[model samples]
Target: MARGISLNRRTFLISTSGAAAGVAATGLAGTGAHAQDGALPEYAAWKDPDALIVHTDRTLETRREAIGAPPITPARELFVRNNLPTPPLSATDDPDVWEIAFEGVASPATMTLGELKRYGVTSTPAVLQCSGNGRAFFDHEASGTQWSVGAAGNVVWTGVPLARVVEAMGGAAAEARFLTGTGGEDLPPGIDPLTILVERSVPIEALDDALLAYEMNGEPLPIAHGGPVRLVVPGYFGVNNVKYVRRIALTPAESEAKIQRTSYRIRPVGVEGDPSQPSMWTMTVKSWITAPLHEPSSGAVVIQGVAMGGASALSSVEVSTDGGETWQAAELTGPDMGRFAWRPFALVTTLEPGRYTVASRATNADGDEQPRDFDPNERGYGHNGWDAHAVELTVS
Candidate 1:
């Protein structure tokens, strides 16, 4: 039996303990606090307490400053957004004890983590971002967490490729059109688990780059971050990643789980969720200034930030000190982690001593450009408009 676990690292960013809270309101600063004492359980504390803003018991938002200039977000500073309560740590004490069941294959079978890792391994750097990352910028009162840009990160996942798993299972069925993943989180008793289940179904083509991940950011996937075995679907929204994925089935149609049939669907404001609404799938182009965000001294202000091309490769990033009216091409810096990962960008220019609004727009190989205004949606999902994300810079 192969206790399947392989992790690799190319250290590009140093781990910072955390930044000082209370950024001056007189200058370029927004939210001031690093930690907000919420009633969430200890599972939320696995991350650096000083590096996150507690939005809810199950949701923790990383501080924009703590996100830093690194393309790979440190696990300690990475945002935490569990669709359900974190399962007890004891259940995840042994990684090899985990198991996964495969269906809709020529030979349907179940395999323990130990047996699965023998198939071969691979790693991929991807933009692991929530579908509601920029929900705070939305004009409407969003339904879920009001996450800003902090609810995202660039993470390298190590796991057995879904293709290998399919091959081991004797290949998928001819009629399979959807790849569905079911989360293994323990649900509340006295209720139907399917009612609140976290199961997602994506196009069968997505399996080309999918993986049964057991490691995140070159470390044992933390229980809070989905320890035993999670499904990593690169180039898709975070919700589609399906943490704690214990069951994967290739089916003819999408999962009928309430989450899929109703929740996370993008619809017009005031409209109720139905089958016709667009599901939050792949991400859109987005970028936000990370440095010079705290009060910066006058003179040479080198603005820096991170940008992602969503489902495609990032082609270019442009900065605008005067909001969206004027734009200038910004230099893409650091290692190109791949099409699924984000690229760090910097704009070197001195701003005149005055108040200014700063923003960044990103374009992808697919020609998907970040818009100045995001269309209104019922849940405020995927708000990547550049103008609404603009930051105010007060330079002396």
Candidate 2:
């Protein structure tokens, strides 16, 4: 069985020559200190105490303590997802020297991090959500992380446009249909190199809106997330945003990488055959109740949470205090961060002592509302069914 490799602060070492050189110069190995001496503290020490380790020490999920966090998720409160062992911070100590190799263009090129910055920088607020955010709620368990509602975050990313880099590489051929990105993460021992790679591809058209971000939420990107340089695809699932990005390739065909062809794709339940389904791209509309973790004692109770509209702006959010039998409009809070960012919503109501099922549903400007029941897919890639997010609460 394929497994995710786990690495802790103590067990993780700078194994690559490029990283070793950076570590030798700065002594950052295992120190948890980011590139510029003490700009950011170590990952283990800075994250919220309520953060849950979803996968070996590498992946973390936000808990109630971080549910109502600001529009821009703090570095410490941001959730984490890794396809491979976390790259050592030393690998990104000097953004100036980092190089990204490009191929399959009219003029294959290699651009230095410094040169890449010459295109100028832009910032945009967006949500990065794992495709499997609600997999845990599936009646049939998914094979990977069983995330609930905490496997997502909204943040403002700062970086150069990916289109700029593509332009610098002499543009793409008309036949190039996909833009593939490769990360610096290492594969576990004994894993067949041919079987998989930490790489994924997006439609070439997406390059115009994508960003190669070096700064997230006003701080230098941290290794825990994708630091030094990570690809940010606004309005797309987190898997499309590659971390520790080191290569960009214009391809005539989509990536044959395992992550692209086999994993991350949504297929009918019990589907069989290779290349069985389409890959997941844009996220589905979804909402979650963050505050009042449990049923509040009788009388008046206030409930709050977040809603995301995927590719469209959120039109409204409705809360149901009694299962899906009835739902009332909830007050949407926070500034309009943009079409791709999550919006905060709240609802207050007086409840009588009893058992209740509390749930929320988000509707996008395009008139797509959350569904009461989303049929299960084989891999559980996108489980946005409203019933999956309902919580059971009992008031004394």
Candidate 3:
């Protein structure tokens, strides 16, 4: 449950009472919204081939039935985000043949995967998300993987605490403020790397909670995923979790690597009104409705899904049947994960015979709520807080 919770503050503010006026009752009638069919919906803006946008919206590229108790999402059900194709490596390769070198530190060292495991490390379940999760909404448009909502997932990771390994290497150097991990080299254009092959890093302080996870979801790492070894950074986007890791190092400044320097950033919170304006970094409160999606037929429907926060734990979840006019509170479940990832939720209601657009907005304990829409940005890295997918449903 480490990845379950809500945002800590409100991401936006609206005059609920004013918007509610003149709105028809019994489920989004006069709100100018429509309902989506029970079938998985297709995306409206898939013009960009590089980016894949995934929201709780109806156009889901992939969605499997929820599985397991304590509910560790199954490996097959677990989502995937790979900048590169799955690699093809021989299983018989000797552990000694694989080497992990430490660089950028005062006294760097290199060791094989077997040697590191002998140090007695452990693992935990954590959620990994793509920083560009809701990128499809960027008004100006950006390049790179345009992932929808399904690009993220939770896994039970088994690995050595990065701190343990770093400390063993004569503790961290005083000048070191960041840790960089380089996975195996990227192969030629056509050669597939069964695992994700890339380099990524994080702040040195974050190492205390980072992991060198070798196992995922209660099983040995699969080749499709990062096996042998991978970097597991909780809370941050999946880009930071470098797969097929081969080397790590301590650095004096923030990493300016491809993934870090060119990607994964959010406009300041106040920029929602004007996305073109420059601002500081801040992740907004956001949530998505997973069930009763599309135009649900008339009768009882269970509204359920999850929400997350960047700096705050989620405080409340609200639903608006008539656009943003009216709001009703939904039940929150498992707020123990501390808001980095989403915790499931539900809201039961009866639908009328009509098309409706269902949306879920979450607020952090700090009073920040999700925005109806955010100003367009160039990169479209952090697109949280905006009104997620509007599933058109026919309640006949």
Candidate 4:
């Protein structure tokens, strides 16, 4: 019944009809987290504290098992990655009154959150994944958080269409070649702003599907997940989706922010980062198993997991019980959520009592498929190697 609502209309993630069908409130089977010291962080109210592995006050990772079998991940089960530190609520006490500056258009102006909402509201499903999502699989000891496979989730975002905003502002400048967004996180003192500022720039083509998102998964966007407003660029890496976005600039060239210049670039393990290196802009084809963490019962065991087409629509998902030696097509269930969303898949087959390695491979509509070994990079970004991401399980 819930699937019918989403299938009938692509406007919202789950329509009011779905709620009427008794699928409204979140009933997470996953664990929730609480601070050992009796303090609750900004995400405490909406997040499952136990389902998340806290790396720090600024970084939280979702447990793979907690991902469950949902086509659209619950807001409470999403991962959180803050570049610097999340600013206080006092700054955004009146979320609707938050201001944003628009530049490089014919008529540059600063508009409040409420003003932008007048343009129109639309929703789309996309994978919000960290560039270093599969970093732990690398042997190079990546510099950032060592994520396994849970630093990503498929969620629906509702917001004003970026193109419409640009048009209302008299369209982008003819010289504009990039779309840059500046986040509202508080900058640390004593550090060069250029080096630590949370700003990112993507190609101008991205403006076509971008959004000044104010909602997530049919609920108000949480502060911990970029509340007042955010820049949602479909098919791009999470870093490009700036949180608490304060500025949208159409520039002749990419912003000179540190994140766009020297950081978040893909380079050789020993190489120094420079503007010439390719930035971690778009994601790559990826998928992973999310079940059977321990021994499964001796009988028919169903293998379940999620797969996504990074920059294109997913074409198919293949499952292999014996590593990559053999493969079988897995059935993708749930309503199709378009190009940028991840699909939940499952394969049910009888397995005798024995140890087995399980792996899943994803192919995108563009014909890009997962590789067996991901190349080692400086920051361990975009590691989608099926062999390295495989899971081992013992059935008894």
Candidate 5:
């Protein structure tokens, strides 16, 4: 069994508060005395309240909620994603020394981290979630990390608008549709034979709302969480949020990098193909119920979860108390941040003590509704569908 799975009650309370603060700090830096310190340090262990919510990416997906309201995952509870542990660089390593280079573009250019920040930067709260977020839910064994539920999270990310950065590297033409980003991570042997060197890219249109963020939760980013800089695609999976970014190239072609080529793509729906099959690039409409703690609770229970689409607007969210046998509408909240963010929806309901299953289904205006159960994939690349959580309630 994977040991990185557990959240206790105490931790939950703490994380909840921190997440709330993060929501408040969205688009702004922290005003706390330690505002200059940076976001909370990664937990010694990746555990949360109830020992039920375990985050392999150090709670990177903790920023998301189930149904009620969208709470900013505070720096404290914000998820941490590190392909590798924190790489330390001394303060003396001149901020001016941090430079970014662009290749495979019409006009490649290099700029220091400081210079990039001075460019057209803006802040927005986006949900940076992992493509394999719900991998554990798959019936078939997957190849990569078997994340149970907490592999994804949402946060108030602050950074320069991606489009502005591209414009700085020589204006983009209408034909330039893809932007490939090469980061500093190198693949270790025996991982994936076809693994593209830790590089990833997205369609240029996706950059309209994408961000080249250097700050997370309103402070200089921690290296463990893609410090220096990273890409934040508004509605895409976390895999697309390439960390330790060193390059951003605008191209008129599609991306076939290792990460984009071998991973993150989804196979045909309703069919279980080879895990290693090449497939579609778009993400499916998805939602999840997060409240009632998935545990049976008596009296009024608040239900909450998030819904997202690839490049579409979320239309509606529905909930089912008795599994999917019956459904009721849930109140949708939050503004459509972009392709990389999920909208929060919530409803309050009363429950009787007993075992129960709750689910949330989201639909995008494009008429794409989440499936009750998505076809299990061999690679567990995409697991977006209706989220069904089972909880037991006891009453005296």
Candidate 6:
């Protein structure tokens, strides 16, 4: 279980009031931490007005109304998840000057953003999704932010291949079993540092597809989105793609970083501190409806959604207007972004004035299909089960 913070309602109200006053006096928005310019990044306020702020003002989840955005999520509208408060690194406008330390190899080295760019750049379209994207839908509430279905985005990442960087650093040692990444975000005051660091690790095998991305969707990565450089692990959950990445180390064993070994692990109900339970890695097959933002008027309506096959390619997505009793194939729309990006699907139908239940399910090329229900787990690390994503809507 996570530790809790205690604060009297009076004290909290007073503190917030004072903060708002400070912001007003400074002519700055009260939405996010101030950057070096003494202002918040433009992207910081790009979210929908109804977006859920799961953690104070640090993490923002997009609302369902904005889920079916463009093929590539707009930089300003992309979801934001910060393990810690976003540092004031926005003061540094020149991404070329940012540096990353590489250690634990035959030749420990460091690479600046400028130097990293010399390796040549490559672009790949992929999806970045929170490991707990659908945690809010769980029958039992889970720790952390209770997110519904909008904690994901599809973007084209432009960067240098991590494998090349590893090779440039003299390659990995024979004993190296994991590649750990550490971010530059700072923890809140009064919090213990040793027990909580925004660090995570992936198996050495993932290096082949990992990247040190500097651009997203053709734009320079914004400060709110880990500008300059961030790790992009294709096919892995968003947590594995550390933002504000500062260091990369080759280790003989998986990182013992709290987030790597404990927080992201999947433990069964009533299980606590069990090392036997494995940590989350690749996401599971999942799909969700995005259209019919609300109750629709009777007539012709279009239902659209997105599906991801996780490590595999998506084979098909089906939609059912009569609950899960029967389903019809949804037309797979949009150009194929890539094997790692979400695929869009749509279904059009006529409806009468009445209430209806709609659901969506996706199947992967590997023959894996979304389940109708999933067993409850602690922390809600991975909610992707056989359960179909269903919504109740009224037509008038």
Name the best candidate (by TM-score): 1
Tell me the whole-model lDDT of each prediction, alpha carbons only.
0.79, 0.73, 0.55, 0.80, 0.59, 0.72
My TM-score estimates for the predictions, one after another, are: 0.90, 0.85, 0.71, 0.89, 0.74, 0.85
User: Tens digit of lDDT per residue, candidate 5, span 1-396?
Assistant: 111111122222322445434323322233342222333334323323222223232333352332235545444444455555344544214544666786655567888788878777677766656667666556554655444345555677888887776776667755777877767665567776345465666767777877888887787765656776777776666666777777777776645565556555566444554336654344668776556553544788777776766557678888877666788898877776654467778878887777555677778878988876667665776776453222222322
TM-score between candidate 1 and the true structure: 0.90
Tens digit of per-residue lDDT, candidate 6, span 1-396 = 000001111111221233333223323343445321223234476444333232336556555556673567776567777777666756348888888998777788888988988877889888899988766656556766655565788899999898887887788888998888888776667976646888888888888888999999998887678877899889899999998889988888777667776778888766774435677778778887777757789999899888888877888999888767789899889778778888888998888999777778999889989987777788876666423246666899
394, model 4: CA deviation in Å?
0.4
Per-residue lDDT tens digits of candidate 2, residues 23-116?
Answer: 3422333223332232323444567644433333554556533568356677677777777767776876887787888887878888877889
Question: Candidate 3: where is the Cα deviation over 4 Å?
Answer: 1-61, 64-71, 91-97, 104-107, 187-197, 264-284, 334-339, 365-368
Total residue pair clashes for candidate 3 = 54
lDDT tens string, model 4, 1-396? Answer: 222122212211111112111111111112223222222356444687656655445556677677867899888878888887676766546778989999999999999989999999999999999998877667766777666677899999999999999999999999999999999988878988888888999999999999999999998787888887899999999999999999999999888888899889999999988999999899889898887666898788889989999989999999988878899999998578999999999999888899777889999999999997788999989988887777776799
Compose the digit string of candidate 3's lDDT tens values, residues 1-396. 011111100001010112122011111222112112222112222222112112223222233113111224556555445565444555314433456887765557998777788767676656666666665444444554343344455567887787877777777788887777776645666743322246665667668768877788776675445666788776666767777788888888655544454344444332332323332223456676556544466888777766665545678888755555567788876545555555666777888898555667888878888877665465666666435433334577
Write down the TM-score for model 4. Answer: 0.89
In TM-score terms, candidate 5 sits at 0.74
As for lDDT, the candidate ahead, 1 or 2, is: 1
Provide the global lDDT of candidate 2 against the true structure. Answer: 0.73
Better of 1 and 5 by lDDT: 1
Where does candidate 6 have its weakest 10-residue lDDT segment?
A: 1-10
Residue-level error in angstroms, candidate 6, position 271? 2.4
Error of 5 at 130 (Å): 0.8
* Residue runs of model 2 more than 4 Å from their true location after superposition: 1-44, 188-191
Could you tell which candidate, 1 or 6, scores higher by lDDT?
A: 1
